[model samples]
Target: MIKIVSFVMLIVVMLQGFTLESDYNRAHQKAMQSDKIFIIFLTEKECVACNKELMKIMNAKNVSSLIEKNAIFVVVYKEQKNTFPIEMLYTTQYPTLFFLDKNELFSCKALRGNIQPKELMNCLKLR
Candidate 1:
Protein backbone atom coordinates (compact mmCIF):
# COMPACT_ATOMS: atom_id res chain seq x y z
CA MET A 1 0.00 0.00 0.00
CA ILE A 2 2.81 2.42 0.82
CA LYS A 3 4.56 1.80 -2.48
CA ILE A 4 1.32 2.23 -4.40
CA VAL A 5 0.54 5.53 -2.65
CA SER A 6 4.02 6.86 -3.32
CA PHE A 7 3.81 5.94 -7.00
CA VAL A 8 0.44 7.67 -7.38
CA MET A 9 1.75 10.81 -5.67
CA LEU A 10 4.73 10.86 -8.00
CA ILE A 11 2.45 10.66 -11.03
CA VAL A 12 0.31 13.53 -9.76
CA VAL A 13 3.32 15.76 -9.18
CA MET A 14 4.71 14.99 -12.63
CA LEU A 15 1.42 15.84 -14.27
CA GLN A 16 1.17 19.12 -12.37
CA GLY A 17 4.67 20.07 -13.48
CA PHE A 18 3.66 19.86 -17.16
CA THR A 19 1.29 22.83 -16.98
CA LEU A 20 2.01 25.73 -19.36
CA GLU A 21 4.56 28.22 -18.04
CA SER A 22 3.04 31.13 -20.02
CA ASP A 23 6.46 32.67 -20.59
CA TYR A 24 6.13 35.78 -22.73
CA ASN A 25 9.33 35.25 -24.69
CA ARG A 26 8.62 31.64 -25.62
CA ALA A 27 4.99 32.34 -26.37
CA HIS A 28 5.94 35.36 -28.50
CA GLN A 29 8.38 33.34 -30.57
CA LYS A 30 5.67 30.78 -31.20
CA ALA A 31 3.25 33.57 -32.09
CA MET A 32 5.68 35.17 -34.57
CA GLN A 33 5.88 31.86 -36.38
CA SER A 34 2.13 31.40 -36.41
CA ASP A 35 -0.48 33.20 -38.48
CA LYS A 36 -1.99 35.26 -35.63
CA ILE A 37 -1.20 36.47 -32.13
CA PHE A 38 -3.24 36.62 -28.91
CA ILE A 39 -1.56 38.42 -26.05
CA ILE A 40 -3.16 39.23 -22.68
CA PHE A 41 -2.02 41.18 -19.65
CA LEU A 42 -3.20 40.57 -16.10
CA THR A 43 -2.44 43.16 -13.40
CA GLU A 44 -0.85 41.05 -10.73
CA LYS A 45 -1.19 38.29 -8.09
CA GLU A 46 -3.90 40.08 -6.12
CA CYS A 47 -6.45 40.83 -8.83
CA VAL A 48 -9.38 38.45 -8.54
CA ALA A 49 -11.07 39.76 -11.63
CA CYS A 50 -7.90 39.34 -13.62
CA ASN A 51 -7.50 35.81 -12.34
CA LYS A 52 -11.05 34.95 -13.34
CA GLU A 53 -10.59 36.41 -16.79
CA LEU A 54 -7.35 34.55 -17.33
CA MET A 55 -8.95 31.31 -16.18
CA LYS A 56 -11.88 31.85 -18.50
CA ILE A 57 -9.66 32.45 -21.53
CA MET A 58 -7.13 29.73 -20.80
CA ASN A 59 -9.81 27.10 -20.22
CA ALA A 60 -12.05 28.24 -23.06
CA LYS A 61 -12.32 25.53 -25.72
CA ASN A 62 -13.28 27.68 -28.68
CA VAL A 63 -10.61 30.16 -27.72
CA SER A 64 -8.06 27.40 -27.22
CA SER A 65 -8.80 25.67 -30.53
CA LEU A 66 -8.77 28.92 -32.47
CA ILE A 67 -5.50 29.79 -30.80
CA GLU A 68 -4.09 26.35 -31.67
CA LYS A 69 -5.12 26.71 -35.31
CA ASN A 70 -4.61 30.41 -36.04
CA ALA A 71 -2.89 32.16 -33.14
CA ILE A 72 -0.36 31.94 -30.36
CA PHE A 73 -1.63 32.86 -26.88
CA VAL A 74 0.43 34.76 -24.27
CA VAL A 75 -0.31 35.93 -20.74
CA VAL A 76 1.65 38.79 -19.19
CA TYR A 77 1.64 39.39 -15.45
CA LYS A 78 1.94 43.19 -15.22
CA GLU A 79 3.75 43.50 -11.89
CA GLN A 80 6.74 41.71 -13.32
CA LYS A 81 8.23 44.43 -15.49
CA ASN A 82 11.18 42.79 -17.21
CA THR A 83 9.40 39.53 -18.03
CA PHE A 84 7.45 41.02 -20.92
CA PRO A 85 9.07 39.87 -24.14
CA ILE A 86 8.28 43.08 -25.98
CA GLU A 87 8.51 46.47 -24.32
CA MET A 88 6.75 48.45 -27.04
CA LEU A 89 3.36 46.85 -26.27
CA TYR A 90 2.91 47.90 -22.65
CA THR A 91 -0.47 48.80 -21.23
CA THR A 92 -1.75 50.26 -17.94
CA GLN A 93 -4.81 48.08 -17.88
CA TYR A 94 -5.08 44.89 -15.84
CA PRO A 95 -6.59 42.86 -18.62
CA THR A 96 -5.86 43.97 -22.16
CA LEU A 97 -5.62 41.87 -25.25
CA PHE A 98 -3.43 42.64 -28.24
CA PHE A 99 -4.24 40.86 -31.44
CA LEU A 100 -1.36 40.74 -33.89
CA ASP A 101 -0.24 39.26 -37.13
CA LYS A 102 2.77 37.00 -37.66
CA ASN A 103 4.95 40.04 -38.31
CA GLU A 104 3.89 41.60 -34.97
CA LEU A 105 1.36 43.94 -36.52
CA PHE A 106 -0.93 45.17 -33.77
CA SER A 107 -4.48 44.54 -34.88
CA CYS A 108 -7.37 44.56 -32.41
CA LYS A 109 -8.19 44.95 -28.75
CA ALA A 110 -9.76 41.93 -27.02
CA LEU A 111 -9.84 43.28 -23.50
CA ARG A 112 -11.03 41.27 -20.50
CA GLY A 113 -14.55 41.84 -19.27
CA ASN A 114 -17.66 39.97 -20.37
CA ILE A 115 -16.43 38.63 -23.71
CA GLN A 116 -17.85 35.28 -24.81
CA PRO A 117 -15.95 32.52 -26.57
CA LYS A 118 -18.14 32.55 -29.67
CA GLU A 119 -17.83 36.30 -29.97
CA LEU A 120 -14.09 36.02 -29.59
CA MET A 121 -13.96 33.31 -32.27
CA ASN A 122 -16.03 35.33 -34.69
CA CYS A 123 -13.94 38.41 -34.10
CA LEU A 124 -10.71 36.53 -34.66
CA LYS A 125 -11.97 34.80 -37.80
CA LEU A 126 -12.78 38.13 -39.37
CA ARG A 127 -10.15 39.86 -41.57
Candidate 2:
Protein backbone atom coordinates (compact mmCIF):
# COMPACT_ATOMS: atom_id res chain seq x y z
CA MET A 1 0.00 0.00 0.00
CA ILE A 2 2.84 2.39 0.86
CA LYS A 3 4.59 1.61 -2.42
CA ILE A 4 1.42 2.23 -4.39
CA VAL A 5 0.90 5.54 -2.63
CA SER A 6 4.48 6.59 -3.38
CA PHE A 7 4.06 5.71 -7.06
CA VAL A 8 0.83 7.65 -7.32
CA MET A 9 2.44 10.66 -5.67
CA LEU A 10 5.35 10.48 -8.07
CA ILE A 11 3.00 10.46 -11.05
CA VAL A 12 1.11 13.46 -9.73
CA VAL A 13 4.31 15.40 -9.12
CA MET A 14 5.60 14.61 -12.61
CA LEU A 15 2.42 15.94 -14.16
CA GLN A 16 2.29 19.12 -12.07
CA GLY A 17 3.13 22.69 -13.00
CA PHE A 18 3.75 24.36 -16.40
CA THR A 19 4.59 23.11 -19.86
CA LEU A 20 4.44 24.56 -23.40
CA GLU A 21 4.33 23.43 -27.01
CA SER A 22 7.72 23.35 -28.69
CA ASP A 23 6.17 23.56 -32.16
CA TYR A 24 6.50 26.94 -33.80
CA ASN A 25 4.25 26.27 -36.78
CA ARG A 26 1.32 25.37 -34.61
CA ALA A 27 2.00 28.29 -32.32
CA HIS A 28 2.21 30.69 -35.25
CA GLN A 29 -1.02 29.41 -36.72
CA LYS A 30 -2.81 29.87 -33.43
CA ALA A 31 -1.26 33.29 -32.99
CA MET A 32 -2.45 34.47 -36.40
CA GLN A 33 -5.99 33.39 -35.71
CA SER A 34 -6.27 34.49 -32.12
CA ASP A 35 -4.39 37.79 -32.43
CA LYS A 36 -1.83 36.40 -30.04
CA ILE A 37 1.89 37.03 -29.90
CA PHE A 38 4.59 34.43 -30.01
CA ILE A 39 6.88 33.97 -27.04
CA ILE A 40 9.68 31.88 -28.53
CA PHE A 41 11.56 30.73 -25.47
CA LEU A 42 14.93 29.32 -26.43
CA THR A 43 16.26 27.15 -23.63
CA GLU A 44 19.25 24.81 -23.15
CA LYS A 45 19.56 21.37 -21.61
CA GLU A 46 22.32 22.19 -19.11
CA CYS A 47 21.08 25.60 -18.06
CA VAL A 48 19.38 24.31 -14.96
CA ALA A 49 19.06 27.68 -13.22
CA CYS A 50 17.70 29.31 -16.37
CA ASN A 51 15.08 26.61 -16.74
CA LYS A 52 14.03 26.94 -13.10
CA GLU A 53 13.80 30.70 -13.36
CA LEU A 54 11.64 30.47 -16.49
CA MET A 55 9.30 28.05 -14.73
CA LYS A 56 9.09 30.34 -11.74
CA ILE A 57 8.29 33.40 -13.83
CA MET A 58 5.82 31.51 -15.95
CA ASN A 59 4.12 30.09 -12.88
CA ALA A 60 3.82 33.47 -11.20
CA LYS A 61 0.24 34.74 -11.26
CA ASN A 62 0.80 38.19 -12.73
CA VAL A 63 3.23 37.04 -15.36
CA SER A 64 1.24 33.98 -16.34
CA SER A 65 -2.04 35.83 -16.48
CA LEU A 66 -0.70 38.43 -18.86
CA ILE A 67 1.17 35.91 -20.99
CA GLU A 68 -1.61 33.34 -21.11
CA LYS A 69 -4.02 35.96 -22.36
CA ASN A 70 -1.83 37.64 -24.96
CA ALA A 71 0.66 35.06 -26.19
CA ILE A 72 1.24 31.63 -27.59
CA PHE A 73 4.10 30.42 -25.44
CA VAL A 74 6.39 28.20 -27.52
CA VAL A 75 9.43 26.65 -25.84
CA VAL A 76 12.41 25.67 -27.98
CA TYR A 77 15.66 24.17 -26.73
CA LYS A 78 18.82 25.81 -28.07
CA GLU A 79 20.99 22.73 -27.91
CA GLN A 80 18.50 20.35 -29.47
CA LYS A 81 17.61 19.71 -33.13
CA ASN A 82 14.91 22.31 -33.52
CA THR A 83 11.64 21.56 -35.26
CA PHE A 84 10.73 25.26 -35.56
CA PRO A 85 11.87 27.81 -38.10
CA ILE A 86 15.18 29.43 -37.17
CA GLU A 87 14.71 32.66 -39.11
CA MET A 88 13.08 34.54 -36.26
CA LEU A 89 14.44 32.45 -33.40
CA TYR A 90 18.09 32.90 -34.39
CA THR A 91 20.05 33.64 -31.25
CA THR A 92 23.16 32.46 -29.38
CA GLN A 93 21.96 32.73 -25.82
CA TYR A 94 21.33 29.59 -23.78
CA PRO A 95 18.02 30.88 -22.42
CA THR A 96 16.65 33.65 -24.59
CA LEU A 97 13.07 34.80 -25.06
CA PHE A 98 12.08 36.18 -28.46
CA PHE A 99 8.76 37.97 -28.49
CA LEU A 100 7.27 38.34 -31.94
CA ASP A 101 4.34 40.17 -33.43
CA LYS A 102 1.09 38.45 -34.33
CA ASN A 103 2.34 37.78 -37.84
CA GLU A 104 5.44 36.11 -36.39
CA LEU A 105 7.46 38.18 -38.80
CA PHE A 106 9.06 40.85 -36.63
CA SER A 107 10.68 40.52 -33.23
CA CYS A 108 12.15 42.94 -30.78
CA LYS A 109 15.64 42.39 -29.40
CA ALA A 110 15.67 39.04 -27.72
CA LEU A 111 15.50 39.03 -23.92
CA ARG A 112 18.57 37.05 -22.87
CA GLY A 113 19.53 35.34 -19.62
CA ASN A 114 17.68 35.61 -16.28
CA ILE A 115 14.55 37.80 -16.43
CA GLN A 116 12.31 38.93 -13.59
CA PRO A 117 8.56 38.25 -13.56
CA LYS A 118 7.66 41.92 -13.60
CA GLU A 119 10.01 42.56 -16.49
CA LEU A 120 8.28 39.84 -18.52
CA MET A 121 4.85 41.13 -17.60
CA ASN A 122 5.79 44.59 -18.77
CA CYS A 123 6.98 43.18 -22.06
CA LEU A 124 3.81 41.17 -22.55
CA LYS A 125 1.68 44.24 -22.03
CA LEU A 126 3.44 45.92 -24.96
CA ARG A 127 1.72 43.54 -27.35
lDDT of each: 0.56, 0.67
TM-score on alpha carbons, each prediction: 0.64, 0.74
Which residue segments of model 2 deviate by more than 4 Å?
Answer: 1-19, 80-90
Candidate 1: residue 99 lDDT (0-100): 66
Candidate 2 local lDDT, 1-127, one digit each (tens): 5346335433432344323655777888888998988888777665676666666665587776677688877766665564665663467666777888876665555677787776677778877
| RMSD for each of the candidates | 7.6, 6.1
Model 1: per-residue Cα lDDT over 14-114, one tens digit each: 34331232566676677665545645444455666665665565567666666566666555566556555363345555666666666556666555555
lDDT of 1: 0.56
Clashing pairs in 2: none
RMSD of 2: 6.1
